[model samples]
Target chain A: MATKKKVTRKNTTTNKAKAKTKTPEETSPAMDNPYISASFWKAMWIICSISVLLEFFIHRHKHFEDLESSVLGNISNWFGFYGMFGLIACSGSILLAKGLSVFLKANEDYYDDTP
Target chain B: MRIITMTLLNNIPPAFLLIIGAFVLLILPARARKVGAIALAFFGVYAVSQLVEGSNVTPEFLGFDLTLLRVDSTSKSFGYIFTLSAFGALIFSWSERCRLQNTAALVYVGSALGVVFAGDMISWYLFWELMAISSTFLILARNNKRSRLAAQRYILVHLGGGLVLLTGILLTIHETGSIDFTKENIYQNTVAKNFILIGILINAAAVPFSSWLPDAYPESTIFGGVILSAYTTKTAVYTLVRGFPGEEILIPIGCIMAVYGIIYALLENDIRRILAYSIINQVGFMICGIGIGTKLAIAGVVASTFCSIIYTSLLWMAAGAVMYRTNKSKCTELGGLYKTMPITMVLVMIGALAVSGAPLTSGFISKTLITAAAEHQNYLWAWLALKVASAGIMLHTGIKFPFFVFFNVDRGLRSKEAPRAMIAGMSLMAFLCIYLGLNPGQLYSIIPNSDILVEQVSFYAIYIKHFDHVATKFQMLLFSGLSFFLFLPMLKRTRTISIDFDWFYRKGAKLLYSGIDKTFNSINRAAEHIVIKTFLPSLVKFIINAPASLTIMLFRPIWEESLSADKTNIKKREQKIISQFSSGTFPVAYSAIFILIFIAILIFLGRSLS
Candidate 1:
């Protein structure tokens, strides 16, 4: 019984040492999370709101006033030309690049033998 | 004393100073060499600026007057960037002990300067080949298998282009009896014009040949990449502006280059390769601007080329710094670097923003000019493509480069900041980025024909008063950031590089060579059977058995051998010859075949002459 108690004490001491050596990041569950924090989401919301609010307050200029105005051009002048066209362009390019990679991406060794 | 001052003021091409300085670098003590190279570069810049506008020199070579130097607005602008690039690169690479690289870089930059000031087709071709050869050494200076192979491919492609360019120059000379390289209606479907365009487009990284830039640039040494990024494509752009401005076909070609770069960059794992593709993308805009052919468009093209040199060099410097510190380039292999390498991260981000045309940066000032010109010319499709490409720039270069390489996953790498020399180099570029952004007038005034525009329109009215423009730009950039994060999962870094068209050359050539070898093997077998089995045996029998005076005199057998022995000897020789006919076994025979062909050519020429 005494020997068993001594082993348990030794185990507990090792556990304490392990805990002491743990990184600050490992100790805190909140910090260890790889996902973006709630604060980031809140900040993003504020940025999005500012984009919308600025468009409403500021007077717009016509781009390419001489040429036949594009249909998308008229729609772009609304509450964000508003953030809509830019967003679509941004997301559209990303998706397009992604689609391209489906056929194009290969292992780094794709040209290994050549160069 | 007056003569000395006159000589300094003489229209001596500044390329002489740099080319001579390259040789001088080898003799100078290591410590002085760096300082000497830098001084030479700055002096070259001064010399270029002092040059007067005219056909400066007509050095006679082989009875042909080659215009060795021409100082004009276009040449001056290009010379400005080329010399400035040498200065920045020398500063960044100060710690590199390889004097050979120093020499190669000097020669590379010197030759590019030569191309800029070259007035005649002959001088242009000379400098063009020199630029290609010298830059190959820069790639080779890395001294690794990958770099060596890349350098080999690089030289082969450049030499091929140089050959095409030479043919075009010769044809032009033959047809027009002039060696001048001035703007002409070269796009009227002439073979010479098409060849010249193809040669220039290869260097510009347009479409199919675009693979070479990304294939080679990433494999360059750290500082070599910075210098490499500045010269080749920009020189091509300068040539295009000089030779083929307003050529309608270029607009579509340029658009393809722009979009293609973005696509390849999005899938690239190596940071340097991404920047390489970005070079194509940026050069594409300039090409498009040149195609538009308006004064504002040309100015925009020049400004963008100039701004790109600064910002792109900064990115290369930053990426080199990261690679120098961590010895890693793949995005997947690098992360949490911002914690240790904050300065590098910050500098890289500044470059990123500049390239993405963030508000109040060099890119915004330059890229907008081109888009505005496109709109003014009513190239709606081109304008729209440019806008989309701008967003794509934001995706791959602006956010992806910094976010993945520095901020994302912490790979537990702790490294010191870039060396002080590199930091100084990057700081200089960053300062220019912001300075030019705030006061584009400094750049605008230098533009050859923008003097009138500069005086009339307040920059504030153009850039700031249009609340819609600024607001829309901001929304695009900021929301692009949003989409990056929202779609971060799909954009995760992977250990892969996208396959490009070089696969056709690298793999397709192998297939071709093998196919030819297989066909040649069968032909060889049939010829061998006829020669060794039938013809040689019958000839030997005739010689031995005819017993003529000629046969007796030639043979004079050393030993009294039986007829059977002689026949056995002939049979053994036939077997030996047949065995030697195995596939690719007789390398000596290949040389013999070539010799025979050469002799045949000589004989044919001799007979024709007689």
Candidate 2:
């Protein structure tokens, strides 16, 4: 993926040079030189792992005790329930937005000539 | 001198001080304007702080008692923040050269303070409209065509909302025979209550009427955007908490707005528009808390309003700084800015984290109170939806805003740091975000209904006493961060806008205009053709020939008997007489003779009948 981005950048730069125009892509550095290093990703992963793991040692109170015990016992009480719920909720909202964009998205000038 | 100062402070409303100072600032020389504005704002804050509880300044107007300076816990909380933010915004815009914008900002801030302290519906309505009118100049001060158009639409919508509020106030006054703005008087008239609610909801940017914020705020000047973000909807939220607490309908409306804001922000390209939409989302939490009406929920709403104003303004300041230096506001056009503008990047990240309710930020402390209030009341669905909205906020604003603007693929843009004034202003707000988060007690002690809130469900005690609660929040927020990276590929920025409720007006207004043009204009044209073109000319012709024809008939027998002539000569003589009468050559004698004869015939018929 990184290699493909670099190739695209090179082609765009050549095209921009031929046209003799100052494009943003021409001034921008290659996409391969990422500002966020590999160490940052590792640190983030470790933090996430610890957060999920800490849920096990902590005693959680049941906000919906009766409903949880009767219908789906201990599911919300599980160690990574909060983490799993967060993950699902975030992804689900993104997917929903993607679907919504099909109908709602328009060009930026959609209302410019409205009158 | 000391006694005079004390009397002045005690008797005068703080709003009046700021308003009067605005006019005074306008006359000062250019160089001293900034100092004047800052001093005025600071004095305004001092006056608000010195206000005693209960009504301080009550003046009679047209036989109605007007409470211009009502100091209660709620009003004081809002007054303190409103004036403080005004002071900060004045500092932020210290270098702004537009004199009109400066005066307008002062008046806008003054009117908002007025709304907070007003105790009568008449005074409240007056200040409400004043706020709407003065704030429009902030957008207009951008002085571009787009900003002009946006300001036009902004004022029209606000004025329309003001009319609706006035109608409700009038009806309530008529029904109750009093103009007090208390909750009981408002609830006295059922129809008036709903009208007032709808009017306030429009200002609150509740779902359908919410498009005005995103439509207008992004078009304001950089500093103007910072000030704009703090006041308008929050004032509406203040009114909501004051007037319509425990209205169950607000729960659903707030939930929909919370999710609606996130969905649109996800697809938005403009960085400022994204922030504008998030304003709607944040206000959703406050509105939902008001719907709960629990002492804890009201406390949460007040605390969050204070915190949200600070963090949101900080975010706008950062965005404004970038726009000021680079002259770009699109997320797709901005990137790698973090490399050069590190201070701005850090401040913006702090704001983003605070908005996402990260553990040690203002959002975490205040937002939890609302959700916890929901849970305590056994509102399982509201609790779940709020949790989802919280995570969604993390995705849209917390991660998406900063990443796209500063840390996305480098676009090779380089710029200097924001102005010293802008940086100082943002730092003040950033400090407040963390300070309030770490010490909830400081915020809790100032929020309205704190005594009741502590006795009911103490948010302060919960965080201080329970470690698991903090851990649970961390687990959710951290995992949401994990999900963002996992799905980073799908979160691509596009040069597009998402259609919102404003489309009804932006596009629907055009449709309405054309429809009216097609329907009514055509009818008008047809009427013009019949009346002026066809019917009027013929009527004039008939009127011109009528007297001649009538006279010819009346004189035909007389001419036939009196003249001895051939048929051709008789015909010629009659035609000549008719022409003379039609041309007015016969003078007034002919007309007078005909009129006398007609009247004599009418009199003969009357005598015969008698």
Candidate 3:
């Protein structure tokens, strides 16, 4: 009985030390609260869905009628044209930046060693 | 006394009043300087408001009729915003005790006002250089090695830019025999116009010369960033509208700037550098508008400048607040700050949304006007590019900034809310962003060419005048936000900085230094070797041996014949004589004979000449 008690005490102390030394990511309340994260993602999706749905109900005046008719056709008048364009532009910019980063990105101290 | 005071108020430009106030700040207690700055800024606004629509002060300068203060719709609008931004920046920095920065801030503001109001090229150039010099102290006030280096580079670039501007002005003056800073005088000489355009574009942070903005601004003292954001580029835009309206080149340049800013901001890790790039992006929109140069486009540019100054400063202030509380600036180092600094997070969101041109914000109203102008002008590519940039703004500043700073995965950082003064300053700008956005008519009324904007307002009856514009912008920005989350993994912040045009100066400067060292210094080394090592020693040896050698040559023939049987004895004697001459112990008669010989040679030459 005495040996078992000692083992339990040692285990508790080690567990406490582990908790104490946890990384910020592990200790963060937001990280532990899965419900909040889930709800936030849900809210984001709902908001985005409504925005896309509103595109169908709302009629957008085409700024480039000639170009649209000649090349893009009615694609610009589609329900999610603005949304898709936004998506493509944003994603394209990020991807392009990522590609460029291979050449352009440098260590944070890049300018520090320089005169 | 009353009459003198009234005359002084009427004759002295409001800009000069703020400058005088800056000197006054020097004498006041450290605590009082802040209040003094705010009061002076308010007084400047009132003085600007009271001015009539002509040159307010004309001073004779070196036989030139200098217009010290000129008031027009454009200058008036710029003047009001400059003073107002000064007031806001002063309030934000109230807690700061650095008297030099406080004084420099006031002077900086004063000189920016001076640039807008100056009616001649000379005074404009003077104020422009003063603006550059005074604003540099704001960066140096950080008093760190990095900030020091950044300030040095900032001043050098501005001085170079000022020289270019002065060259342009001098050329324009010579060509026209007038110093008036009018479009007619400027555009009369093509070279002068191009020089002036390049000068202003450098300040405007247009592509290649733009790296200075991001390089220096983020390194500034926290409050300095807020003040720095408001004036320099906006003043350049003001000048562009005043001088280079309808220049077609700015259209392409502005497009490239917009796209460049978006790409860089996407790659930047520092929160403040991202804001700095967005300044370029926002200025690009205005530059594009100025290029359009229609009455509607000009009005849009002016209105957008006013709105951009407020919103961009707001964003800087919020970032500064975060930096102040946590002493961390990189987005990768910060996360879940909303838990501790909710007020700052909210203010930043407002600023971020406004910058993104979200619905019912000041950006929405101002940014749409530019696009509307582009569409009206049938520049389909510019319109499409601008729309893409608008969504780009949403991606970089709107979502990326706030997300990485406040809402990303928790980093377990904690800090109290920003100082009350910061909050108050931010709230003031935030209120204006929303206020001007909700009621853009207030801003439109103050903008240059207001009549055209009003006409367009009625024409677009579908824009802010209706809900369709709102819906369209909403659909675009929200979808952009959706894209942000979908690609969150790709947008991960790393502890890295993206190379910019400054790479030429930052890295290329060292390359240049080494190149010069190798070329010039090596030549210098060769010259030293020839003169000191080879030439000097040989010349000394020849001079020392001259008299002895002459004696030896003269006597060697006689000795060789006389001592033909005793050649060894003659050789020993000759060596002894040469040693005596080198040791300065030779007979005086030989030196006398040599001097005589030199005199005889001179006499012979003189005889020949005769």
Candidate topping DockQ = 2
Q: lDDT per residue, candidate 2, B1-610, as tens digits? A: 9778877787788888888899988988877988999899898888887778888577888789898987898888999899988888888887788888788988998999999999999899999999999999999999998899999999999999998998999999999999887889999999999899999999999989999999999999998898899999999999998898888888888888898888888888899999999999999988998998888888889988998998999999888999998999998788878878888889998999999998778998889889988877766667777888888899889988999888877777878888889888888888988888787777888888788556324445656467687888888888788787877767777788889888998899999999999999999999999999999999998898887777678877777787754668678877887789666677688678878999999999999999
- Candidate 3's C-alpha runs over 4 A off are A1-25, A28-36, A66-79, B1-10, B455-465, B519-610
lDDT over C-alpha atoms for residue B579 of model 1? 50
Which residue pairs of candidate 1 clash?
A76-A81, A80-A83
How does candidate 3 fare on TM-score?
A: 0.83
**Stretches of candidate 1 exceeding 4 Å from the true structure:** A1-34, A69-79, B1-7, B185-189, B455-459, B519-610
Error of 2 at A33 (Å): 12
Cα miss at B205, model 1 (Å)? 0.7
Model 2 residue runs over 4 Å out of place are: A1-39, A66-78, B1-4, B452-464, B519-610
Q: What is the C-alpha lDDT of each candidate?
A: 0.82, 0.86, 0.86
Ten contiguous residues minimizing lDDT sum, candidate 2 chain B: B455-464
lDDT of 3: 0.86
Candidate 2, RMSD to the unseen true structure: 6.9
Residue-level lDDT tens digits of model 3 in B91-200: 88878988888789888988998899999989999999999999999999999999999999999999999999989999999899999998888999999999999999
Tens digits of lDDT, candidate 1, B431-549: 88888887888777766567645642455855677656777778878877788778777787678888898888887788788899989998899989999989999998776544333
What DockQ number belongs to candidate 1?
0.30
